[model samples]
Target: MDKEVIGPGACVLRGFVDDPAEMVRAIADIAASAPFRHLSTPSGAPMRIAMTNCGRVGWVNVRSGYGYAEVDPLTGHSWPSMPAIFTRLATHAAAEAGFADYTPDVCLINRYTVGSSLHMHKDRNGFLKDMPVVSVSLGLPATFRFGGQGNGEPPRSIPLVNGDVVVWGGPSRMNYHGVLPLEAGVHPLTGNTRFNLTFRAGVVKPAPRLGSKTG
Candidate 1:
């Protein structure tokens, strides 16, 4: 795998996964346990991307706000456990990006089709700030926007394809980033869709102040 530093605390490892098919199969199993759904935003609008979670805690957005939960509100059951392979891949990628002893406790899986995209945003839901985020891309391709910590300036666009892994932390931890709208395409392995796995380490803190955000 070729690793390139994209920012102070971020790097992308091109063709990191030798066998993406195996990962795809594993994802199928995970989805069977915790089905993907369009989670609602705080504003009550459905998210554009389909999402599910695996591991001890999963990212969630509800009327209450953004946070992590052990149980899927849709099913009232714990999210599927993080597969061993998933943990290893995330750790290895993080370590390669200069984050040592990285242990992520949650994996957020996002599914996107043509026209699906994530808006530029900071990953600041959890109490832990600046935790390293390891993202693996599979199936299709998309443009990634990497921006400065502040939102005023425009972002740099990068293309992410299957088997590519990107790790962000350190000085780039709080930098804004997002995926641009996907174009229509098909991949031999994933076909008509793209799957992105983002791993994060989080610890639930006390409820926020009245004016602060809540999950």
Candidate 2:
């Protein structure tokens, strides 16, 4: 993955996916197992885009609050593990961004339509401060808002195309970021919806075993 420094502690790697078709197909199959659903914020506000999870820890929100859980609340089962392809991509992207040996345990799959957009926010999953968030964009085009910590200054609008990967870590790990409303367009592969897979390394907490007897 050839890296292009976009900002201080931010980088973009182009054409990271050798076979975008295979990646798309893999995602579709994974989604069939774990369907996408729009998640609600802790404030009870519904998110714009529908999302799914394919990893050890799936990000979820409910009346309780926002955080990562080992089990999928919708299914009462553990979220799907990250595919080998996704792991490879995550490692390569992180390396390009100067983050060595990154193995993300959480994979957040987000789906977006023409009018779908994400509000600017930082990821606070309680991981190492230097672990980068590797985001892979496929399907439709959208403008990504990249800003400094806090909401003081205006963010730079970065155009993301299909097969592009963005990695943020180090001083920029907590930087605020989000996506603009997706533009109406059809990709030969994804057809209509835009697919974004964000890879994040989350702390692992052992879950209780089923049918275990306690003294």
Against the true structure, whose TM-score is highest? Answer: 1
Task: For residues 1-215, write the lDDT of model 1, one tens digit per residue.
Answer: 89888888889999998778988998999999888888766676788899888988777764466677777766778889998899999988988888888888889999999999999998877646657999999999999998898957678899999999989888888889999999999899999999999998855552232212212
For residues 81-150, what per-residue lDDT tens digits would candidate 2 score against the true structure?
7889999989988887888988988888998998999998888754667788999998888898898887
Candidate 1 ranges beyond 4 A from true positions: 206-215
Report the number of the highest-lDDT candidate.
1
What count of clashes does model 1 give?
3
Q: Residue 184 in candidate 1 has what lDDT? A: 99
TM-score of each: 0.92, 0.90
- Residue pairs clashing in model 2 are none
Provide the global lDDT of candidate 1 against the true structure.
0.84
